[model samples]
Target: MKSKNSLIPLIFSLIFFHSAEAICKPRGFDYIQPSSNASTSTSQQQQSPSPSAPAPNQVPSSPPSTSTPISNANSNPPSSEPQPPSSSSSSPAKTFTPSPAPPPTSSSRPLAGINLFNQPTPKTEPTTVDPAVKKICDSTDYPTLCLASLTPFLIVGKTDPVSILELAIKASTQQAKLALEAATKLASAPNLPPRKASGLSDCQYMFNDALDNLESAMDAIPSKDYGTVNSMLSAVITDSETCEDGFTGQSPLAEFDDKLRMMGSNCLAISSLISPII
Candidate 1:
C-alpha cells in the first residue's frame, strides 16, 4: 500500500510537469507571433481535457504561471544554468514593431478663392429707333448724335416727320441754353485768361442767339415755314464755330459748344425735309 501510494504521486507529478512544459515552452520563432499562436492553438485543441489544463483565453498571455518560477531559476548564464529552454526561450519568441505608426497627415489652409463681393450687373437691350428718326438723322452733320437726341421724343399729333422737326428744334434749344449758362459761369471767374475770357464771353452771346434761333425754328414748324427755319438754324453753326475760333487751345465749354453745333446741324437738315410739306 505505501509503494502504490508513492508511485501514484510520482505519476501525477510527471503528468503535471509534461502538461506545464508543453504549454509554457516557446517555439523556435522568427520575430513573428501568428504562426506560433496557430501551432499552440492546434496543440491545445488536440490535448485531452485535464482538470489542470489552462483556460482558452489564457492561451495568448506572454508567460503562464508555470513559467515564472522556471524563468527565475534559468536567469543565470546558460553555461551555469543547464535549464530546459521552455523558461528562458519565451523572451525572444515573438516580436511585432506596430507597423511604423502610419505616416502623419499634412495640414491644409482654408481656401483663398472665395469671393464675398460677387455682384451681377443689370442688363440693357439695344434701343430700336424709328425709320423716320433714322432717315432724318441720316441727312444731318452728325447722324448718330441726331438719332440719339431726336429718337427718344414723341409727337402728340404726328408720329414721325413733324415730330422730327420739333425734336430737332427742342434738342438745339436745350444744348445751346446749357452752353450759354456754363459759359456765363466761366466768364465770371476771377483772374480768367484773356483769350479764355474772350472766348467764354463770345460763346455766351452765340449760345443766346442760338437759343433765339431755335425758338424761332420751333415757331416756324407749326406754320411749315421750312425756309425761314433752315436760314435761322444754319446761322447757329457759324455762331458755335466763331465762339470756338476765339480760344487758343480746347475751350472750357467744348462739351456744350460741340453738341450745340451738331444739334444746329440736325435742326437745319430736319427743317429742309419739311419744305415741300408747306
Candidate 2:
C-alpha cells in the first residue's frame, strides 16, 4: 500500500507540469499577459450570453479584446484642392451715334416790275391855224360892234334873239380891237377887215371881230393870261352859235354864217398843241 500512494503523487506532479507549459507558451502577438485573468475576463465577456447581443440602442464601455493591439495607418496626401472657377464681372453696354439733317433749296427766279397789259397811246403833234385869221380874230377891241353883226338864220324866216346877238356882237368887237392892239404890240402884219359894200358890211365887220379875238387869245397865252385866252375862245364859240341861229332862214345868210365857221376852224387848229387845255 505505501508504494502505490507514492506513485500516485508523482503521476499527479507530471500532469500539472505539462499543463503549465502549454498555458504559458508565447504567441506571435507582441503583447503578453502575466496571468490568465485577462483571457478569462475576455472569454467570460464573450460567452456570458453577450448581454443578449446588445440592441442597436445599447452602449458598450469596454475596449476591444483583440488578439493584437491596433496601430495607426499611413494616409495618402490629400488630392490638390481644386479652386472654384472665379466668376467674371460683365462688360459695359455699347453706345450709339446719330446723323445730321439736310438744308432747304432756293428758287431760280427773282421778283421784278413789268406791265402785263399792253395798249396804245395817241400821237401828240401840233396842228396848224390860219395865221391871218388868228391874228385878227383874237383881239379884244371893239368887242360890242363885232358881236352885233353875226346872226342865225338856218330856217328861212327865223330870227335870232336880239339880246343874244347883242351880247355876241359886244364880245366880238372887243376881241377885234384886242387883235389889232396885239398885232401892233408884236410888230406883226396887221390883219384888218376891208370895208365891205352895202348890206354885207356888218357881216364883214363881225368876221373881222372873230379874227381878232382868236389872235388876241393866242397872244395872251405867252403872258400867262389863260383866263383872257379862254374867255376869248368862249366868246367866239358863243358868237358862232348866234350866227348859226340868226342866219338859219335869211337870204345871203349862208355867206354870213361862213365867217363864223371860219372862227371855229381856227380854234380847232390851235387846239392840236393847246389840246392839253381840255
Candidate 3:
C-alpha cells in the first residue's frame, strides 16, 4: 500500500512538470521572443506564473498598447518640424509689395522740339522819303511848285529826273488843252472883231504846236535821251509863250495869259531839272 501512495505522488509531479513546460515553451506559430542567456532565462523562470494562472495572450496584447505611444511620438515630431516651414511660408505671403511705376518716355511730351530760350524776331521796313531828292527839287525856278507837284511821286519813294519831267509834261498838256478849247470857242463866237478873231486863230495854232512838243518829249523820256527830251520840252515852253504873246497888247485876255505863263514856266523848270541828271 505505501508503494502505491508513492507512485501517486510521482504521477502528480510529472503531470505538473508537463503543464509548466507547455505553458513556458513557445509554440511554433506564436510570436518569437529575443533569445536569453542561461542566467536571464533562470531569472525569467523564477518570475513566471504557475501553470494554473491565466493564458499569456493578454501580455502579447500589451505590445500594441506600447506601440501606441511610439506612433504618437513619431506623429508629434513631424508636426513640430513642419510648423516652422508653414509659418515661414505664410509670413512671406502676408507681407505686401507693390510694383514700381513706369518711367516717362519721349512719346508722352508734346512740345519736344520747341525752344523756350530763343524767340522769333519781327521784320521792319522803311517808311519815309530820302533827303537828297528834296535838295534837287529845291534848285528849280518854281521850287515850292516843283516840290509840291512831285510830292505824290516822292511819297512812293521815287524822285528821279524822268519822273519830274513826266509830271511837268502832263501839266503842260492839260494847260494846252484848256487854251485850245478856249480859243476854238472864242473863234466861233458871233460879233467878234477881226483882230480879236485873228489873235484867237493864232492862239489855237500855237497851243496845238505846244501839245505836239509835249507828246514828243514824253516819247523821248523812255529812251533816256535827255538832249532830245530837253529840245522838245524847250519848244513846248516857246510855243506857250508865243500863244500868250499873240493875245498880249490886243485885249484884256487875263485868264488865257495866266494859264500860258504857268505852262511855259513849268516846262522851263522841268527842262532845267533834267539838265544835271543827264
Candidate 4:
C-alpha cells in the first residue's frame, strides 16, 4: 500500500509536467510572422499618405485668397470710370464766348483855342474844301473875295462856323489897325498942307470907328448873336467907306485908299455871309 501511494504522487507529478509542457510550448512561425507583417503594414499605412492624397513636394490648394481683393476691385469699376467725365462735364469755363468791341465815333468840333492867324498858310492847295465853308462863302455878295480870303484859314482844318467868323473879324480888325497907322503917319508929316492934314485927320477918326465896330463884332460871335455881328460888321463897312471917301477928293492917299476899300469890301462880304445865319 505504501508503494501504491508513492506511484500515485508520481502520476500527479507527471500529469502536472505534461500540462506545463503543453502550456509553455512556442507558437507556429506562420501565425507569429503573419501577425508581425500585418502590424508593420498597419503602421506603414498610418505613417504614409494614400495615393489619392497630395504629394509632399506639392502645395495644398484651397479657395484662392486673392479672389476677395480681385472681386472688391471689380465691384466699383463702372463707378470709377464715370468720375472723370462727370468732373469734366461740371466745368463750363471751357465753352466761354468773348464779347464784341464797340465802334468808334466821329467828332465834329475843332481843337479848342487854336490860333488861325499864328498858323502858317499851306503852300499847296487842299484836295477838297468843306461844303459848309463853300455854302457860307457862296451866300456872300462877293463870293470870290470871301472864298479867297478864307481859303488860307480853312486849309488848316478848322471848319467850325464860329471859328470862321472869328477869323474874319480878326482880319478886319488887323486891316483897320493898319489904316489907322497910315493915317497917323500922314497927319504927323512935316510941311503938311492944311487940306491934306484935314483929310488924314478925318481918315483917323473913320478908322477908329471901324476898329471899334470890328471889335464889337468879334465879341458878338461867342454869344452866337449873328444879328448883332451883322449890325457891327455893317457899321465897320460904312466907317471904312467914309474913310476912303475922305481921301477921294484930295490927291488920293493911294496906299490908304486901297487899305480902306479892301477893309470895307471884306466887312461887306462877311456881313452877307452872316445874313443867312441870322
lDDT tens per residue, model 3, 80-162: 44444654454454656887988767457544333322222212212343565556555655554545444444435455666
Write the residue-wise lDDT of candidate 1 on 69-167 in tens digits.
Answer: 345664864586475667645576577667675643423322222221221111331288666567667777677777666644655445476777787
The residue ranges of model 3 lying beyond 4 angstroms of the native Cα positions read 1-134, 148-155, 248-254
> How many residue pairs in model 4 have overlapping backbones?
0
Give the least accurate 10-residue stretch of model 2, judged by summed lDDT.
113-122
In candidate 4, residue 39 scores what lDDT?
A: 93
TM-score of each: 0.52, 0.24, 0.46, 0.46
* Candidate no. 4 TM-score: 0.46
Error of 2 at 36 (Å): 99
Best by TM-score: 1
- lDDT-better candidate, 1 vs 4: 1
lDDT (10s digit) by residue, model 2, range 1-278: 99999999999999998789768666764434446667855655555556646435445555445576445567555569886556685656878766665543323322121111111111231243233322322432322222223222122332222222223334344434433333233233255323212223444445466666667766665565656666776666665444345332452434334334444433333332243443
Superposed by TM-score, candidate 4 places the C-alpha of residue 174 at a distance from the truth, in angstroms, of 1.4
Please identify model 1 stretches exceeding 4 Å from their true place.
Answer: 1-126, 155-157
Q: Give the better candidate number (3 or 4) by lDDT.
A: 4
lDDT of each: 0.70, 0.43, 0.62, 0.63
